[model samples]
Target: MFEAVLVANRGEIAVRIIRTLRALGVRSVLAASVPDRRSLAARLADEVVLLEGRTAADTYLDVEAVVAAAKATGCEAVHPGYGLLSERPDFAAACAGAGLTFVGPSPETLTLLGDKVAARDLAIANDVPVAPGAEGTTDAELAEAARDIGFPLMLKARGGGGGLGMRVVANPEDLAAAIEAARRQTAAAFGDDRLFVERYVENAHHVEVQVLADAHGNAVHLGERDCSVQRRHQKLVEETPSPVVDPSLRDQLTSAALRLMRAAGYENAGTVEFLVGEPEEGRRPFYFLEVNPRLQVEHPVTEAVTRLDLVALQLAVAAGQPLPFAQDDVRFEGHAIEFRLNAEDPWRDFLPAAGRLTALAAPGARLDTGYEAGDAVPSEYDSLVAKLVVHGPRRRETLPRAAGLLEAASLDGLRTNLPLHRAVVADPAFAAGEATVQWLERDLPALLD
Candidate 1:
């Protein structure tokens, strides 16, 4: 096991990683921005390094500063909780150059999977079905390619996530402007201006597969999650054992996900996302979306159903250990759901909300968070303040538990997406197991009205 690990991110994920590291007897080192001095993770970790800035660029994303801190603190490795430098191939390569272990996939795998277009081609080669559109993210020949792919398309940023650099073009007149906007956002967010055009599907469902691999050339899928309930391309609610997915579809998704991971020589925890279409020719179909190269924000739901500690698995894999269990040894016995409690007002177009979190008490099966009452909710980062995860033998048993959890929830000082989550749990369409990508976009948008 690594003797010491540095957490290179902020908010709930950092805290979550520290907890697991502490249990494994690994010293946890936290790096905080000027305003993050009082963050929960900083307080909870064994040691804290105060960086000299408020902006992420000034601190967390500053590679030299982070590596210097790691050296100064004598941390042996870095565990990028989820975002920030999690998928940055350069950072991983730098860590290797510095003789510091990066607790994730190799740099080659990150470079291979981090590029969306290239990954799509890799997917097709591995027999994974992909949406018809876009040559890839680095397709510098976009206008020519866009002209070929046709309008009513999707303009996506090469280095984008959480839907930052994505735009839908319904007409030829909108393509150029949409592409420019996506390029700008992608550049600002990812430092890469690569863009691509792809065929856009209307009203699709978002499903994801969680896969884990080890150094022994073995990988296994932990089943599927339906994260179709989203706002602005960001997922709001995630559930395991999608009610609408049949056993066959689940197997196909699982098989393809494992293939992609093995082909990329991926290790540890990663998510393979897909877009499932609504029944068009009387048969519902799914297409590859993208792969998140880190632990997902909703991984607890998977843990609840599978009874596995993914963070621990990551640690084991990073240390070059084989998986303790085989593919068939994994079991999925129940349905699980997780709701992201963000400090955002859903009715106001889901704008980011920030302020002191005066009070917070999660009400689901289990609550995971990095903030408590009196913690400041900053506007700079992701608004997710807490996660409410619940589990049961089936969806029917789980639905009521979800409703009660929401009703019992209480948060103050910061506007949250709680009410929106409440509405979704009570929504008849959602309750009847008929949620699709179009469900939120077209069917009354079950958010807080």
Candidate 2:
């Protein structure tokens, strides 16, 4: 393993990476922005390279700055945790040009998978199921494609994730406006205004497969995660060994994921997302959504069940080490759930809230956080404060424990969505694993009431 590596992001994910680096006996160098100079990640890192900016655009997203930090710090690789520039092909290329390894897929793979249209085409070519979609670069093309895709289709940006630059058009009359709006947003977000249309599946379960590949052409899937409970297409809760996915469906999903990754010559960790529609005539339909070409925010849930340190694997793969185990060697032990504790109030339209955490405590659960009792949550960047991961032998036994852990824990100073999580755990629908992608938004009032 490399002696030192640079952590190219912030928040709890940065802390998460540093912990794994320490365990693997690697020195961690953090490229921190001005606001995170005194943060938890900065404190835990073996060294800190100040990015000298406050906002994300000026700091974490600065490709040149991050790459320079790694060079100046004498680091061999850079680990971009989740968001920011984690999946940017340009970022990976810059690292490569600087003679530093990026702890993810290659730039060519990133470029191929980053574009939604390209990824969809790859899935189709690899015999993986994909939703009916068409790529369009102009308004006329999109409008024409929308007709073929039928009404109630989704207009999505060709690049980026986290629900940005996406729209649902229910009628032809609104297609023009939605196209203009999505293009503008996509241009601003991803610097690419290319758009596509896909048939939207209503009340679908958002399931994803976690696949790991090495440079030696070895690949294996840890399992599947159900992230159906979402708000505005953003996942709020995730669990491994989806309550609805049986062994047969599991095999199909994992096999499809491995096939696509191998076809694309992918390496390191990536997630293949799918939309599973309700069963009809003894058959359930699943369509490929997109591939997240980085370590996800909900990766802890997979680790909880698989007993694998994904960060270590990422580093080892980047260092040109072959995978130590094959598909048959991997094992799943139990059911695991992860709740994203965001600094947002679920009651007031889920608006982001920022303040000092005056009191914080979680007695007997795996809470991966970046703040302590006296830390302040800044208004900039993502509102996620921490991730609460809990594992149990089965889903039946996990729900009550998760609910009790939330009820017993204390987090103060800012409004949080703990109340909503508590409600979901206790709600019969969620406990029974019947919640869909739209369930959270459609039933928000009932959940928070």
Candidate 3:
């Protein structure tokens, strides 16, 4: 095990990692921006390195500064909790070049899976199904390719994640404008303007399989998560043992996910997302979406069900340890749900709400957060302030518990989607596990009113 490590991200994830590091008897060095110097993670870590910036560009996303901080602190490895530079292949390679272990997959694997078009091709080569799509580098090329993909297709940024740089074009008349807008957004978000088009599955369920792999080629799947409850293609809620998947479908999803991991020589914690659609006249049940080559935001749900500490596992893997268990050794019990508590007002088009947290409370759930009642939520960063994870013996039992937790929450000084979450858990469609990707957008208005 590593004696010391640096957490290369901020907010709740950094706090989450630092807690795990303490449990594992590893010293944690937190890298914090100027604004985050007094944050919860910074206070909790054994040592704090103040990166020289207030914005993400010169702070968390600065690979050179992060590596330098780790080296200066004598950290043997770096754990990128998630988001920002977590999925960047160059960042991984920089760590390698700096003689520090990155607690994720190899740079080659990151590069291969980070590109959506390449990942789709990889899925196809492995016999995993993918939606029909074509990659194009220019506006004219993309526009030309859309003619063949047909109407109601999705315009996506090849290098984008977190639901940015994506648009749904219902007709040819809007293709050019959508393409330009997606390109600009993609460039601003990911520094890549490449785009692709794919046929959209309107009512598909977004399911993802979690896999843990070691450097020695041993890997195991930790079942699946139902992330269909989304807004703007970004997941809002996630749960394990999807209510819609049966034994057979679960096996298929897990097997396909494992196959992709093995083929890519993947290591550490990663997620394979898929779009699962009801069988149409001739279509298959599921199509490969993309690979998230890092610890996911919703990893707590998987940990609750599998009874495993993923951060510890990632640390072990990076330390050259083989997986302690195999596929059959893994046992999943009960159902777990995670609700992302973001500082946003759902009734007002989900506008970001940033302010001092005057009063805060999270009851009836396990809370993971980086802020307290006195912390300030800056407008510069992601709106997510905390996560509430609930576990129960079965899926049916989780809904009411989740609802109670949301209702009992007493956040103040900033508007939140607590009411929205409360509404979702009580909604019959969601309670019945029939919520699709479009359910929030299509049905939330009626529930709110």
Better of 1 and 2 by lDDT: 2
Give me the runs in candidate 2 sitting further than 4 Å from their true place.
none
lDDT for 180 in candidate 1 is 76
Give the clashing pairs for model 2: none
Over the stretch 1-449, how does candidate 1's per-residue lDDT look in tens digits?
88998888889998999999999999999988987889998889999999898888898999888887898899988888887889889999988999888888999999988888888889999999987776544434776677787767788765657788888888877767777777778888878878777878877778999999988888999999999887667788899988778887888889999988898889888999998777767666888888898899999999999999899899888888899999889988889999999888767777889999888886446888888888998877778899999899999999998999888988899788888888899999899878876577665443545
Candidates' TM-scores?
0.95, 0.99, 0.97
Worst lDDT 10-window in candidate 2: 276-285
The local lDDT score (0 to 100) that residue 408 gets in candidate 1 is: 93
Native-structure RMSD, model 3: 1.4
**Candidate 1 vs candidate 2, TM-score winner:** 2
lDDT of 2 by residue, 324-366 (tens): 9999999999899999899998878889999999987777889
> What are the root-mean-square deviations of the candidates from the true structure over C-alphas?
2.0, 0.9, 1.4
- Report residue 266 deviation for candidate 3 (angstroms): 0.4
